[model samples]
Target: MTRENRRGALASLVRTLAVALVLLLPAPAVLADRAPIAPAPSAAGVLGATTYPLSLVDDDGRAVTIAKEPRRIVSAAPSTTEIVFAVGLGDRVVGVTDFCDYPEAAQSLPKIGGFKPNLEAIIGAQPDVVLAVRGFPAEIIANLEVMKIPVVILNPVDFTGVLANVERVGDIGNAHDAANTLVTSLRQRWDAVEAKAKGAAGRPRVLFEIDASYPGSIMAAGPGTFIDAMLKAVGADNAVAPVAGGMQYPSVSDEAVLGLAPEMVILGDAPYGQSVEALAARPGWDVVPAVRDGRVVTLSQREVDVTSRPGPRIVDGLEAVAQVVRPELFGPSDTSR
Candidate 1:
């Protein structure tokens, strides 16, 4: 196989693993039924304190009780790590997965494996609580529980779910004040983008490219995914949604993309060396409206991380999409965080 083929195979394997993990999660309807914990403001306008022995139903539909504030945390996913740090609990994070690279501080933390966690390493961390997302093996969770370690699984399906997870983490770490403030700021940013989108001239059809390493098979973000939600929230239509065949992430042929006629193309894989120039050079791709019109937008590494990761910065992802889809309405996005 050629180098491109190897990359394609690797990408396919990664996607397969991601889908398999997501399948382990409870249905979206089930998670939606569980109401998010609302933080109450104190007389001084700060969020009220969290009560000890806090009990709540996590996204995985499991009853988890945190006896007291967690002093040491183990994050099993990048999103979970971001949530822990965002809620002002970074100092308490003892271990993070190999994939967790944001916030600079997490980079120096001990690694607890990725995709498949290192059970021994996790145990060595001696964490007060283990924070994880969907896709972690059920057996691992059971093993941790048997060892008297609390595992909180957080799997948010949409924007609202992300905010709720942040609050939930705060509650576990007794950082309700920081979580409330962060959620409020995120909501304000979301509303601001939505207001701008409402004033746009018209909604444009956009294609979010997940991987373009293999020209024979192009991966795209489809319905029921964070990318799709961000596009819709910013008042743009997903060009691949109609032909996705119920898959959250689908591989499409060049013909299919041509038929979709996307007005704008967002390169979610730009960090991996994909570029507007490279895309334009592809055979027959130049005729595509987005390419011919030079409407291909390449996202930076930080942009890709914020857009793809379901964490506190997802609102930043919404704004990034808005800037690309409706540049006249929204200005350049801030990806500094």
Candidate 2:
């Protein structure tokens, strides 16, 4: 062959050798080196289909929208924290209110302060979403926006709002199915309790006290509050309705409670860790008809405080009342404790 032919032939031989080496490489090695990265799941999948249009009217009246499902969430209220955990998004929650005690798991999560919130602590969590109650101060909400953390404010003060809030949390957490089951079960349980309570021949008169020491300034449930609705649901008459103006910290008089004469008194587990006996022993409480008759019954703080938080807990609350007011209706067992 000529010199030029030899050079061309040499180049062709080199190319063939290179191709042979490539084919002889181990398949596993080739694959391991050239493997493609898997794409992350879309926001919709993370948030759930029901949450696609997730948005809320803030306290300032602006329609705040969360364009995507949040991976790191900060809940500003105890009730909202409970709602988040109930909806099965507890794993995504990175921050919670200091008082969130339900589900037991919440105790381990980072606390972002209470209803007022600690903006710096919230920001430190690097949350993509922040949950707040509608009545939260507008200025705090505005600050959250300034930090670029999306906020969804929920208002679950009444029965209807509580149901709505459950769905809302489910939507936010991409757990609509769980939310539906939760709300439906709650309704059924409450309905069953109501039916049983109503069937009783005698409906007991009840007085619910928030602070027993201050009988003249007692905080009681009246119409429109969850406790008020719960009282009626369990077929009990509220003694404070006439005295309470359907607002928090309703001013009730000693004479009013004495005059209404509640056959049963429902006390919430307040000043946490204090027992029913302690509340009953408080000064001036002995004068209340409920205390005098040994009718005082203590309930979980979760059931009464921050009423109608919108979840299965409300049913638990109503059930508690039924057991207290009409024990025979709920069978002989005490399920309220």
Candidate 3:
């Protein structure tokens, strides 16, 4: 071959050998799909469809808008903490209040104090979202907004509000599917309680002592209080309502309780290891109608407290209250809560 032909032939031979070497080698790796970093639930069909930059009015009536999903969250109230965790955003919670000690895992998170929150600690966490209750000072929320953080206030006045709060948190966190599932189960549980509660015929007069610490006057749950609402749901009348003086949770004198004449008295302090016998032993308490009739009912402190919190577990509180008020309705052998 000529010099030019030889050069072309040599280049072709080099290219052919390079192709052969590549073919002789082992095959390239077939990479597996990478796991999602956020781990959100599959919720496309569960909620029909979701539109972002959604605007919502919070329990505080503040018109808040969320432009995108939040990755790091700070819950300033125990109720909000519970709502966030229920919506499957527990992992995203970077900080919670000192009192947000439910679901076990929440107990270990960094504490930002309770109702009186430490703003610096919350800001240090660099949260994209902050959840507060109704009582949070406007100044704090405004300052957080000044820092460009979204603050969603959640204040559930009653049981329904509690359920709505869960969906609200879910909507903000992008976990609507989990929120729907939670609300469905809660409604079912509520229906079951009502089915039995509706059967309570006596409409027994009930009295609830909020705690043992309050003295001089008997602290009772009145109309508009969660405890009173629960009492009404289970077909009972709150003894404090007629005499509540327009207060949702009122303090009454000895004469007031004696006059109302509750057929059943609920000692909420029982959860603190207070005893029914001790309550009955109070001066002049032996003459109280409920005590005299041996109708003073002691409830599971923890369970009953749940009802008073105005959160998702309030149903559990209502269930305990129903069992206490009307044991017979639950069948003879099914009185355990």
Candidate 4:
């Protein structure tokens, strides 16, 4: 080959190789940006460490740290307040939202506000630490920070997350022993219920009624929801169609419910004394098999909330629901009823 021609060919080869390398190699800067953010170690993460340093990421993604155990704590969400008590931090909680109505002790505690908390009430309590769930408005979070109140947002949208939160609260409240015991007992109860469900003669079709008052106005767990996860764990078939419809809660037509004809109707346990009988009487509900066979089941509001709030109580809630969904599996000795 001529030198000039050979040189041109080699140049072309080099260009092709360079292009391949560019495509194959990842950009270091982008990779660095995409890396996971590691959580700082709480005492629970440390080997044999009893006292743990605590800090929680707020709703705005800001870190709120506590040097030691908080003397006075305020729970911004009703479920979170329940968790505080579940983790043995009830004495520390000075104030709770109006909806926190568990363990009886919580009802007597001063009320700050409801879903949208009042900043003035929260501040007046002078809480050293505040436990909140996700979706706290930016304005409220900003004001809390400006007033120098530390807000620790708990992420408990499922069973595992609930257990993790219990351990976390135990670590934060210096109630590690209680947390460990609670988690262990919770695991035991859950295992028993799960075993029963798996051994069940036949898993019944379940339709969870979020709002039975209006049979047409229905919300059910379809996919990626804690309720759906729990139902599966307890070996029940979810009647709601699982598809990519963002949590899969739709205003299902009466015709559709009638056609689906679930074996059992699972009613949400609401605070205002709601039941499946109410659902049965709703327009176009008399045809449902659950109503016809008297298989309508009522669960407590605490059993199925948006996020299962990572705690021992969630397992308790799961077992309670399982008892109703599959009474045969739970057996005659079942104390859940």
TM-score of each: 0.84, 0.75, 0.81, 0.74
lDDT of each: 0.75, 0.61, 0.67, 0.60
Residue 37 lDDT (model 3):
17
Residue 308, candidate 3: how far off, in angstroms? 1.6
Off by over 4 Å in 3: 1-49, 212-215, 270-274, 331-337
Better of 2 and 3 by TM-score: 3
lDDT at 79, model 1: 84
Q: Native-vs-model 2 lDDT?
A: 0.61
Clashing pairs in 1: none
What ranking emerges by lDDT with the best candidate at the front?
Answer: 1, 3, 2, 4
Query: Per TM-score, what order, best first?
Result: 1, 3, 2, 4
Model 2, runs deviating above 4 Å? 1-48, 51-53, 58-61, 215-217, 246-248, 269-289, 300-310, 331-337
In terms of lDDT, model 3 sits at 0.67
lDDT of 3 by residue, 1-337 (tens): 7634543332222111111101111111111122211323543345533477768888878888767677789988766776777667888889988767665788899988764788899899889889887667688888888988888888776778878987887788878888888888778877887787876667889997754434445556678877787788888999989888897656677766777878888765443334567667666677877788777755442444365565566676677777667677642222232
Residue range 1-337, candidate 1, lDDT tens digits:
9755655554432332221111121111110011222222321234567888989999999999888778889998888888888777788889998878766788999999977899999999999899998768899889999988889988888889989998898788888788888899888988888887887778789998887766666888889888888898889999999898997777788888888999988776654556667778877888999888767766655566666788887777787777667766775322211
2 against 4, candidate with superior TM-score: 2
User: How high is the lDDT of residue 88 in model 2?
Assistant: 70
Instruction: At residue 228, give the lDDT of candidate 1.
Output: 89
TM-score between candidate 3 and the true structure: 0.81
